[model samples]
Structures are given as C-alpha cells and as structure tokens.
Target: MSIVAVLNTKGGVGKTTTALNLAVGRALQGRNVLAVDADRQGSLLAALSNRGEREPCIAVAQYVEGQALRQQVLRAAALYDDIVIDAGGRDNTALRAALLLADKVIIPFLPRSFDIWSLDDMSALLVEARAIKHVDAYALLTMSDARGTDNEAAGQAVPDDMQLLPTTVGRRKAFADAGGAGLSVLELPAHRDSKAMAETQALLAAIFN
Candidate 1:
C-alpha cells in the first residue's frame, strides 16, 4: 500500500482538486483507493460525499491528532491498495505528522509570488519527510498559464533545487466549476480542454505508477 499526501503551505493552490482527481483517477485505473481529508475544513470529505460507497472514505481528522494514524492506515489498507491523504496547508503538528506518515509527498503550488514563496517551506518539510519515507517526493505548479504571464515560463519551470512533476494544471473555469459542486473536473467537463485533462491525468499516473 502507498500513502500519497497532497500538501502545500499556501491556500487556494488547487491542492484539493489535485488530490480528488488523482485519487479518482487511481480508482479508475483499477486500484481500490481510500482518500483522507486531513485539512480541518473537510474539503476532501465534501468532494467525496456524493461518492456514495457502501463504506465511507476515512477522513484524517480522526487519526491526525496522535499515533492512531498507524491504526487508521491499517484499517483503510485492508480495503484499498492506494491511500490518498489530503493534508492541511497551514504549518502545524498535525500536518507534520501526516507528512511522516506519507509514502510519497506531493506539493501543489500556484503561479504567483506568494505561492512560489510557499514552496520554500514545502521543500524543508519534504526534506525531513524523506528521511522517514522511502519514496520520491514531487512538486507541481497548478493553475499555470504559459502564454499569459512573463513568469509563465519560469512559473511552470521546476526549481533547480526542488524535485517536481512534469505536468502543470492550467488555470481553467472547469476546475473551479467542478469544485463548487463537489466534483472533480474529470467528472465534469464543460468543453474539451484536453491539455488540462492530460496534465492532470499524467500527474495522477505518475503518482500511482
């Protein structure tokens, strides 16, 4: 079993969107998936509410406070091959614990100055996180538009010192619309934006494979 944690220090970076779509994509690939909402706001839980499975997905709030995390993982692992943990953006002990529990870590950043600044903290956390986990950690820039900004090229460009994923989820109305209805963009496509979908899919594929 693998524990994939979606995290970032800054809010509104599409961390939840990436988490939801990636887990759904993993499930679509024939891997049973358990998704956890570690954020206090329950964004992941809200998204999965309509999932309507006989058994509910495990939200991380219950286990994030203590060593109960091991038990939580054990219970969920019995039912799913993949476990996706949606961690909080703020710096806290709970978030640190989630990172320690993750097999692989994903930091989703937006293409803005403050969003870029958030990666500094993300990098430090993962550095310590890697000492505990055996897998590679990745960073992905979300809501990016290459043709729009002067920083576009550099925005999507992976930091030389940081490990990053190859795909960047572009700014799109579809993503925002899907989140409002508690659905992943993959589940709700208004128009054909193959680029965004492909980028998202590649990120999901890379995390699982």
Candidate 2:
C-alpha cells in the first residue's frame, strides 16, 4: 500500500483539496482509498462526509494527535490500497507523525511570495523526515495564473530536494464549485470545466503513474 501525505506549512495552499481529490481520483481508478484528516479544522472530514452518493466512495478518518495519527495509519495500511493524509497548515506533531510514515509527500503552494517563502520551513521539515526514512516528495503549483510567468518563477523557486511537478492546477471556478458540493472535478456533470478535469487527471497521473 502507498501512504501519501499532502502537506504545507502555510494555510490556503490547497493541501486538503489535493488530499481529497487524490483520494477520490484513486478510488475512481478502483483502488480502495482512506483519507485521513490530521488538521484540527476537520475540513477534509466535512468534505468527504458530504460527497455525493453517486461519487466514488473514499473511506475517511480524523486523527489529530501525533501518536493516534501514526498508529491509525499503520493499522489501516493493509485494509486500504492507498492512504491520503491532509496534514494541516503548520509544522506540528500530527504533520511530523505523517512524515514519518508517508511514502510520498505532495506539497502544494500558490505561485506567490508568501507561499514561496514557506517552502524554507518545509524543506527543513523534510530534511528531518528524511533522517528517519526515505520519502519521495514533490512540489506542485496550485491556483496558478493561466497567463503569466509566475508559474515558471515559482517552479524555479522550489527547493532542489523536492522535485516540482510538471502539471500545475490553475485558479479555476470548477475546483471551488465542485469542492463546495463535495465533488471532484472528475465527478462534475455535463457543464463541468474540461480544463479543470484535465488538470486534476494530469495531477493524479503524475503522482500515481
């Protein structure tokens, strides 16, 4: 089984969104997925709770404490094909615990100054995480402008240790709209934005393939 953690030390970086979508996307591909909400806010839990009945079902659990999070993930590892953890927006015990067990880490950041600055702390955390175990980590640019050099600049700014994903998710209404309704871009209806679906699919392919 693969355990993936979507994390960032800054808020509003789309960690929860990435986790949610990745879980649902994998489930759609016939993999049993467990999505863990390690954030105190419980947004991931709430989102999965409200998902449409017709959408692919993703098992979810909320564990905020460090040891609880780690223990639960280990016990459930064999039950599910994939586990996606939303590790909140800070460097805390829960986040640290996730780093200890996750096989892959996906860090999402907006193409902006504050987000770029936060990567320094994330790099240090990854350094600490690596000392104990090996984790494949990748940086992704989210909410990127469709027309600008910001994406390129932000990609260049990513720490050398963390490879930047080639696929960038643009700032789109489809994500917000689908998310509000507890749905992924891939699950949206006839009027859904094709670009949004395409971007999300590309992201999943980059990570899982």
User: In terms of lDDT, which candidate is strongest?
Assistant: 2
Clashing pairs in 2: none
Q: What lDDT does each candidate get? A: 0.71, 0.90
TM-score of 1: 0.83
Stretches > 4 Å off in candidate 1: 53-66, 146-161, 189-192
Q: Which ten contiguous residues of candidate 1 have the minimum total lDDT?
A: 54-63
Instruction: State the lDDT at 202 in candidate 2.
Output: 99
| TM-score of every prediction relative to native | 0.83, 0.97
Whole-structure CA lDDT of model 1: 0.71
| Model 2 CA deviation exceeding 4 Å by range | none
- Compute the lDDT of residue 19 as modeled in candidate 2: 86
